[model samples]
Structures are given as structure tokens and as C-alpha cells.
Target chain A: MNLYYRGYLLGDVRRFPHWSEPSDAAGAEDAALADETIVYLRDDFSVVRSPVGADQGVLWDAMTPQWREFCDTVLRFRPPRESADGPA
Target chain B: MDRPDLGEQERGQAVGLPYIVQGGGENLADRLAEDRAAIRDRLRTDGAVLLRGFDVGGTDGFAEAVRALSGELLPYEERSSPRETIKGRVYSSTEYPPHEEIFFHNENSYQQSWPMTLYFHCVQPPAAHGATPLVDTRRVLAAIDPAVVQEFSRRRWMVVRNFHPDFGLPWQQVFGVADRAEVLKLCGDRDIDAEWRSPDQLRTTSIRDAVHVHPDTGEPVWFNHIAVFHMSTLSADLRDGLRELFPEPDLPANSYYGDGGVIPDDVLAHVRDCYRSAATRFDYRRDDVLVIDNMLTAHGREPFSPPRRVAVAMAEPTDAGARP
Candidate 1:
């Protein structure tokens, strides 16, 4: 299976900030050039984008060390996810 | 310190200390009225009242008794709004020296609504000074000019809640109504405006120019644009500018009216003089519970020696607009 690690950029994401499926490679390229490009890592972990998106979870899992470091460095105050027991 | 005088003790609680009722089989209404006639009358006529001897005895006993009584009268949620201290939910007067010449006004007057009744139980009354002076707003209204009353009734007034940094994040976020939409919704057809601003190191949201009438009596009240606009603590410039605009109708310093604005200076001076002239002094004895109508009367304490303790509980209307 050919996997394309694609994501959104900071600027483009601002217009449509809510979570959504990734656009095609051409659109991603346009967003990249527009400076709205976020970081995107391929299946092999080579390509890097300028901005990041929520859809990069799969790419993040593949590069555990880099992903952990990036999260610790950038997103300092992310709240813990709710447990299966549900909200209090 | 004088030994507990048995003679004074047997005469009921000594002067200036809280006393407890073991269990008096009296109808609540009758008891409230009979024991607190001065306060009730003040409430009916003035919109506020105070009883001095409601709480007396040892500090712990007074606090516990008040807490229990308050729990019965008010719900848990309502009780949460009270100021807490090491002694109890209600801060004792002993912690802070009472302000002398404390002017007449409602408690938390800046809010959209305020407590309908306020009760102060005297744990210890000052040996000298510390007499709670009372005033009735109805008398004030009756005393003022009919033309002035008519004009105020017709006009909408403004209220601005200046945000204070001391409120911290949680308080700042949830200080007033839940949100702007809530305020608009609650205001309904009333002609009003609101602005959120940062002033004096506090983020504040001010509601401008709203009209309100007394819910029960349907009396045309001057609700709006007094404490928040003209009070010295809020904005001196706004108050001064307002005075300049309505020079003849300037609000008096250190005083407020039920109409939700500053009582006019001339009227204020007259009322102040009347209060001063009619002032009466009394001391507190233990086991007395004094209740007053929050809206009908204004209350103030005379200065006193330290270690004076008092517990307070405020009663409010179940209906949102009935009292504030």
C-alpha cells in the first residue's frame, strides 16, 4: 500500500480550523507554497512540513522519539484525554 | 478583663455578646415581626434594616448556630456566595475595624440583583460606638421632589462592572452573567447597552442604560447607572463627567438610592442630616437574632474597640427579579 503522509499548514488551517479530512497532494502543495503548510512525514519519515495538523497521529506513532520530543517542545499545555469512564 | 458578671449574665446575655435561643416555640413570621419590628418597619419603608443583638455568645457557638440557621433558610448554592473566614462562612466584624460614617447603600449594589434581606448577629458589640444606624429609602423618595422622581422614573440608567485583577481568572471569567448573550436575554426588551473594558488593572464589563421597575410593587424605580457609573471607586472621570452634564442633579458622595443611581447631592445632604439628627444608639446582648429587609433600610456601624465579632446572613427572593 502506497501511503501519502499529508497534512495542513498553519495559515490554510486558520480559514477552516475545525477538524476535517486532508485535501489531495495538489491542494497540500498549494497550501505549502502559500505558507499555510504544516509538517507532514511520509511513511518512511523523510519529508517535513512547516506546520502540523491533528491527522499526523499515524506519522507521529511511526517516529516515536521525534514525535514525543516535538510534542514536549511545542505543545506544552495539552490537557489529558478523558478516560473511558466518561466525564465527571 | 472583668470576670463574667453573674448579675449581668442572668439578665440574659451580657451587653455586646451573642446569645442563643434554646428553642422558642414561636411562629416564624410573628417572631420575626415582633422581635424585629424596627428592622421590618425599616425594610417596608426604607428598603433596608438591621438588628444588632441577633447573634451573641462564644464565637464558635455563634458561628455554628448561624450556619445551621442559614442552611435552613438558604440553599447550599446561595450560601456559597457568602464571604468565608477562619471563624466561618460569615466574616466576623472583629477581623476588620468597622468603618465609621459608613454611608447608606445596598450590599453588592453593582450586581444586576442584590440580596433582599441582610441579617447581622452581634457576637460582641463595641463598648462605645458601633451602633447600627438605619434609613428607609421610601421616606427618601417621598421627601424628594415629585418632578425629580418623575424624571428619574422615565429615564434609563447605566451600570458598569469594572473588572478587578484581584478576582483571578475563574472569577474574571464568570463574575457577571454567564455571557453577553445571557445578559441580553435576561434584559429582554429593556433599552440597554454593554461594554467590556480594562480599567485600573481589572477587566470589567459594564451594562449601560437599562430601565428596571420594582418587581413586587411595580414601583417605577431608578435602577441603573448609579454605583457603577458615579461611585468614586469605579470611575472618577465618568462620575465627574456625569455631574458636569447634570450639574443640578449630581449624585452625592458615599451614598446610593434604590432607584439604582446616586441620590442627588442636595437630597443626599438632606437625608444625611436627617439620619444624623434622628440617630439612636443601642447595645447588643446575647441570643438575639435581628433580621432586616435589605431593600427598605440602610445600615452602618459605629466605630468600636477591637475583638468585636458578628455573623451575618442575607435572605433573598426566590424569584430572580423580585428583589436585588
Candidate 2:
């Protein structure tokens, strides 16, 4: 898929919610937003804020709240899938 | 400046080989709990991701980070290197002699099932060198001669391992079971061909794809132990010594064509060059945790002076047969 983390500028998530550039090239931060917001990634790439009090994001795994927002937001990143009869 | 530490790397060199996630001294386990999926996606895209300046308490804390990011840690199976267990799922990174450099290899590439992710935690930076050099398998594949790649793809490659009494690990240790029947059952299950040369000596052979498709990225990658498992890859001194000590069929470990034909020495040399052309490295600092998407990147050790300590964990099982 086109969605990949080529490179990104790191910042305090508090100060930089839209921390990473939307494309592969590294660029200046889009310092326009200041809340727990899902920003731009290619259409396939998405970010969700970890659910507040009760609205658990569409996932069942335990995670730090911030990550709860985007756990299943990307490629089928479930735990390594195994069958009732596991890997040979 | 030539040392290639995180600051020097971020200053605009190494092509930002793998994206860096600066934790700003935050507890890494905590950060992992928050955005493991996003972090993992970043890793899958970059082939590797460096988690620098984070607080990974110790072996215990490192396990916490692994569980947070990977959900479960895969136990060390079909063992090769001598790794000492420190805590649950956290083991000392390949206790090869401190002065010997390990050639580049994807972990468990020869096996039927392998971990999709590997996390290396640098507990203490080595005194001199000891950087874990990394090679993008996609880049390695791109650099190889297409003919060489195609020939290997068609023929596949075979690994012949000899567990001897004098040289190499005993089969009991490698198999982790003392019972011969259990070992045979495991071999049959894993599709490995096993033979008993002598009562205490065992020889096993397995054939696997030299090129494999990345599970997430879907790109065909040059992924195999063809070179590393070949006899010619060793230094002339060691190669000659081993040859003199054992018959060709009884060497500690060696590789051949899937049909068991000899792979020319020249082909092995060309393969090594492609890996070299695509390799990159960064010096480790204490608390630098490197998370690798195992299929996308091949990693190796650079020989270093003593006092270097790195912890490792593997997770996310991906079956080899699942790929087309």
C-alpha cells in the first residue's frame, strides 16, 4: 500500500498533533491544529485519537489511550494470526 | 562525526535509512501502549525504526515494550545462536565472540514459520564499535543480478546442517529435546529431512525459497540463508580448517541448490556484494531500542570491544507457506 512511514519530524505530541508530513519527503510541521485530531496520511493511512472515557475506538486490544485511536486504523495489524493448529 | 550516532545520523546523513521516533525520554513502554499500530506501520514502511532516547528500564521493561507493540513474543525456536535468557522472552543478543563480526541475515529465513518483527534493546553501548548494521532486503534484491536471482528462485536453496560431537552444537541442544523421537517428529512437522549418520551425530536438510514476498508490503525480497549457510562464506583459514577436519557432507552447516547441486563459489561472491552495497549502520547509545520488520530488513553484528550489551525479542509469527 502507499501508506508507509518513510520519515517524519518528531515533536511533543501535545504541541504537534499533526507532527508528521503527509508525504514521503520530510518538511516543516503543519502547525495549524492543537487538539486530539486525526490528520492527513495518504487516503489509506489514518490516525484516530485513543478513545476518551467510554468511546473505545473500534478495537479490543489494551493500549495506551493515545494509541487506541489508531491501532486498527491501518493495515490488518492484528496480533500475528495463528490457527487452532499453529505454525509448523 | 564518523561514529554514526543518533544525533549525527539525524543531522542529515545515512539518508534517514529508518525513520527515528524520538521518545524525548518518555517511558517507551508507555509510548508503545499508546500508538503501537502507528509505530509499527512506520516500521513496516521504513524497513526499520529506531526508538531513541527512551527509558527502557531493563530487561523487564523491554519485555513490557515488546508485549505492548507486538501483543505476544515468539519463543526462540529452531535455535542457532547461543543466547542466554535474562527475563521472560528477553534474551542476550547472540553471544558470539565479541571480536567476531556476524554477516548480514534475516532471522529464521530458512524456517517454515518466522517472526515478522524483531526488537533489539541496547542496554549499554559498546566501548568501541558493535553497531548492528542493517541492509534493506528490497535494496539487496534490487542490486543482485536478475539472472542470479531468477536462477535461485527457480532452483530454491537447501540448508544442510550437521550436529557433530566434535564441532558444532549437539542435536539435543539445537532441538531442545533429548528424546530422538521428539526431534524426528519436529523435523517431520517442519518439513526438514533428518538422518542419523552415527548414534550421536545428526544431519538435517531443508529446502526454502531464496526470494520471498513481504507479508505487509507485498514486494518480492531477497530473503534466504544461501550465502550465510554456504561453506565459502567463511574465512579461508576457517574454511580450510573445517574442510580438513570433516568430510563435505559432515561440515557444521552448508548450503546447496534445492536439488542438492553445488552452487558455484562465484555466485556466492556476487550475492555477498549485493548485501554489502545495500547495508547501513548506526552506533548504539544506551537505551536505544531498534525495532525491525524482519521481512523487510536483514541485520548483522559489527565486531566490537567488550562491555556492549543488547537485548532482543522476536514477535508476530508469519508462516512462510502463507506467501505465494
lDDT of each: 0.37, 0.69
**The best candidate in terms of lDDT:** 2
True contacts kept of 2: 0.00
Q: Taking the tens digit of each residue's C-alpha lDDT, what string does model 1 give over B1-324? A: 111121322322112111122224333333343444443333443343222223244445444443433322332121112243434444543233343233444444445455555666666555444545443333334433566555545543334333334432232233334554554444343322333333323223333222234554454332333432334532355457646743322232222343456556654343343333212223444443444454444455555555565566555543326422
Regions of model 1 farther than 4 Å from truth: A1-88, B1-89, B93-100, B164-200, B203-281, B318-324
- Scored against the true structure, residue B180 in model 1 reaches a CA lDDT of 49
Per-residue lDDT for B122-222 in model 2, tens only?
99898766878777777678667889888888889999998888666668877788887789888989989998888878889999998999877787788
Please report the candidate that would top DockQ against the real structure.
2
Task: Kindly report the docking quality category of candidate 1.
Answer: incorrect
Indicate the residue-level lDDT of B298 in model 1: 43
lDDT for B285 in candidate 1 is 42
